[model samples]
Target: MTSTPLHKGIHPVLEQDHPYIFIDACMQAWPDADYAHAHRHGVTAYAVTAFHPWAGLDEALEGLMFWHLSARRHSHLGIAWIAEDIRHAKREGRAVFVLASQGGDFISNALHRIEAFYRLGLRMLIPAYSRTNAICGGCLDRADGGLTSFGELVVAECNRVGLLLDCSHVGKRSSLEIIERSAAPVVFSHSNPKRLVDNPRNIDDEQILACAARGGVIGLAPWGPLVMKPGSRTRPTLDDFVEHIDYVAQLTGSADHIGIGTDMSLGTYPDHEHDPWGEPAYAAVTREYDQHVTADVRSPLRAVEGFSSYPEVLNLVDRLQRRGYGEADVRKILGENMLRVFEQVWR
Candidate 1:
């Protein structure tokens, strides 16, 4: 006899139906991937990151345009500019890929470039990534120095253009300042809690509280390092990932603020010579530092066990329910919470 799956009764419509919205808060679209894969995952929408920290304006456009052209060529893909686009994509059995920029450097101090990309379907942006830049300090920066004067301007511009502000790779101090400054609620687009995993890029209790206080959302990523403890080579389980959801719920007093940022980054650098390790910022990131550092982002670059891709996202609902999350809260954690933010922020 076969045992009943845990999620069957918990989320009856999850595996078979697509009535409710399901989104991947973070999806990578590199030139190397060279195709739209979100459609195959059964996800209703994705916020696609087609950029890197060291990429300049020219390189940034190339990445974004690569997807833009693919979406045009592919019948299954569409660029989501607003919440309606996502809804429509769901109705049409399609997946909408929203263009995103992970680093602020591509704008190169040209504030209007923010809106320019916005017009081209960029709905989200993280002003800094891993290291300090003209806009703000990053999580891996030697000294946070907090948000800069220019960073404040960037926040206002993002708000003005209705770009959803993200603090995933931003420094703690800078992230806090950004959350406080933005008229719109900012997001930790794809970060986990520091207390759970101790990664430098993860958010802390203070950041979580600050974000939740302002009606922001904390999007947890399924990256192995973020889910499992550092220095552990053991395969991370779904339980390990769900513990984070439980911790956030207990800490914030609600699951209203929790969401997924699977960080489903796929593809390689094409070859070793083209690897990002050649960059100065990435070099410092690999260096053993007392304050801000990374623990080999290339160690298999895998997701936690039982959650290898978007199709497996619903497993969280069952895990969460068994862990005692109510149906409404589990829905919020899966996708509703982020969609709520989208309706409020995006034009």
Candidate 2:
């Protein structure tokens, strides 16, 4: 797995990074079967999404409890209660799991559900997916009503209950409100930069600075279409992904607020390593690319070279070192930043 973009060797110090916490802040879902491979690939902890778009209370509990059961049954999977728990879990040779939800609809306008979920070991919540909900606005809705009165309560409740707030897939207006209102740092768990790809799912400079201003970290996603250069004809390579780290670092004058949120599932397109944009998640963006862009939509849409699976993630450490990032910054981008947020909000 020494496949970094270009030549310079890894920094000698980084080569000995045994106790570092490498967290993938956003993995859409992590089934119990993948726990061994996740740890084998150096995964320390991850935020695994549980519920779906319109999943109500019953479905929500079912989704969350699945992970709880996994941790109990599987020796390789450990449940992380606080940010510090990740450190202990990693030392114990387990891949820690942070229970997360991608949408707030699961709560069904019941704020008490937040506290219940917290008690159940759910540590992060994304309030909205891709559609408008009672709590907040969505990224692809008819209008941008920003965060509503109910959404404000959700934010306060999240703050009180130690649930990490995520803004990915949320509307710009609503995302901004969450960033400002949160007493603790926030996260865009699985988003890219709009300057690179121009997708609505990607955030702009204003959003970037606002998030960073409040001491938050934005996880850079490796999802092909989201971070590929605007007008690019090929899929995102290791360098293509690192280019984003470069872009955001240069944009903010620091790498303290950046991390990796893979936003992908390992072994998804197994037969086809470079998966096509045919999944339900890519629906809206694919349509927009096909209709508005220069018809390069179906150009094998990631049917070319790219960062394909999870086990290949260590290559990123190589890539960042090749790109001249120092050890502390690279560590922050890898997992420390997310840990800092969790500790501050959850403690």
Candidate 3:
């Protein structure tokens, strides 16, 4: 007798026809992969990291333009400026693209650029990345100075333009301050919980509660060290990834505040050297940090068995089912939670 498929009678959330909304909270646009490959991944939406603190204003603009041009080149891609755009992309069987700035450096200290970038289809902004900026302290900064006057101004501008504020790479004090300051819900678009793994890039219990208190959702990142115990020789399993989700759920007493933001890039950092915006561009951004410090900043080089790519999201869903997560909760974790925040903040 032939065996039935594993997902054949699984929870509806694990079904391919369940109208799944897989959104990667953070990812880099690789020159080689392009939008064509991105559309084929079965992900409904992606928040592409078009700008970061390390890039100069001009380079940031270039990166934004590259995404714009790619969207124009690919018929299956459209910029998701609002929640409706995401719904429309799903309806049209295409991938919704949302540009995100990983740092305020994209504005070059100019406040007016917020609206301009919004018009250009940037839906999310992280006030700081890994170092101190005029607006706020970065996670790796020497001091957690919190949000500066200019940073408050940026938060206000982002709120005014309906841009979703992200606190992923921001320092603890600054992240909390931004959450408290913003009228809209804030997101740690691609961050893990520090309670699970003690890393600068991870958010703490207080931070997680603050974000949930503001009705924000924390997108669990799948970067190696963040997912697994620090310095573990073994790769993180799908269960390790879910533990972050479960921690946030149990901590917040609701799965509504948690979602996936696996910060997977097209390829490793070294592979981008041949691209137009390659090592030189990234190097300029990390010049202040010691060489050793900047070298290990990329996502974990090792691939987890079932948590490798977008399609592996199904694996996550299956694992969630095995873990006894209800279908509604699974749906929320898969995408509804993030979409709810998007609808609220992107208005």
Candidate 4:
């Protein structure tokens, strides 16, 4: 017997009809076999990477099968490691993969590497992440510096290659710096508005306005701290998530500048097990030396109930649809808006 969609009981409309959802902001670290679990709810996975593969390219390729199987019903992909995955996915008729880099760390202070990676299909580059890198500083950095000399070259090269510049992890000063220097539309692929929630990772009103003014789209991530306040452990409800979307809509002057990346590392690790809080398996061990570092982000896995599964995003969307969002708006929020930005900046 077929199981009901995750939103079935929550929303009567979902009981009978589940909307087709194309996820654009998924990570590649999760096991590939898990895609089928997402597919059961009508989600098509578009796997993205941060360019730092643990076992290298060969192992990363192994995850594509999971992406291919869920293609017919759902397909949207990108973010770092794009050259290999994008070409392969396109050839397989799975879906178009949009290349993205989580941080400028991959470039290793060289524009030649940036050029080579772009030629290989790198469409977007995040200038910074959780720490200071060659290009610039991240949100967590003590000083929010923007676009180093190398970062300038990286942005120019991205323009030359038609790759988009992303500022999600870049600090406030850096985000604006990139915005001012970028010739193409820039993105905050998986960030929330600080106006709603006070996280440093979340963008403030000015940042949101700048992104929209440049014709760039801001992908609101559904992760907890960026959107809600539930004591120290409980996850935010769907309403909290919508409030973020709504706040962004008001900030950007339209929903077209807003989209959902979800940042849902679903089927991956729960809150307590993720990085910045968990052991430093991926980054430096000393990064987590202070136990207080993981405080707010730690505990009870703040993922929305029924929303953790990839397919449930559409359920949230449909709920928004009923609340009076036009179909055109829905289309943009789903994937069209991001695609528009991609086509403009990605060669």
Candidate with more favorable, higher TM-score: 1 or 4: 1
lDDT of 1: 0.76
Instruction: Please give each candidate's TM-score.
Output: 0.86, 0.85, 0.85, 0.74
What ordering of candidates by TM-score runs from best to worst? Answer: 1, 3, 2, 4
**Local lDDT at 31 for model 4:** 40
Write one digit per residue (lDDT tens) for candidate 1, span 122-207. Answer: 88898888889998988887788988888889999999999999999999999999999999988898899889888787889999
- For candidate 3, write residues 1-347 as lDDT tens digits: 12221321111122232367777788765665544555656577888888655677788777888878878899989788788887787777788778998888767679999898888788898888878888898887778899998998999999999999999989899999999999999989888888777766788999999999999999997766566665455666778888898899999998989888877765334322355564222213222221322234343333344675566677888988898899999888878888999899886
Off by over 4 Å in 1: 1-20, 31-37, 266-301
lDDT (Cα atoms) of all candidates against the true structure: 0.76, 0.75, 0.76, 0.60
Cα distance off (Å), candidate 2, residue 27: 0.9
RMSD over all Cα atoms, model 3: 6.7
> Clash totals for all models, in order?
0, 0, 1, 4
| Candidate 1 clashing pairs, residues 3+ apart or interchain | none
lDDT: the better of candidates 1 and 2: 1
> What ordering of candidates by lDDT runs from best to worst?
1, 3, 2, 4
Pairs that collide, model 4? 44-74, 78-98, 79-100, 80-100
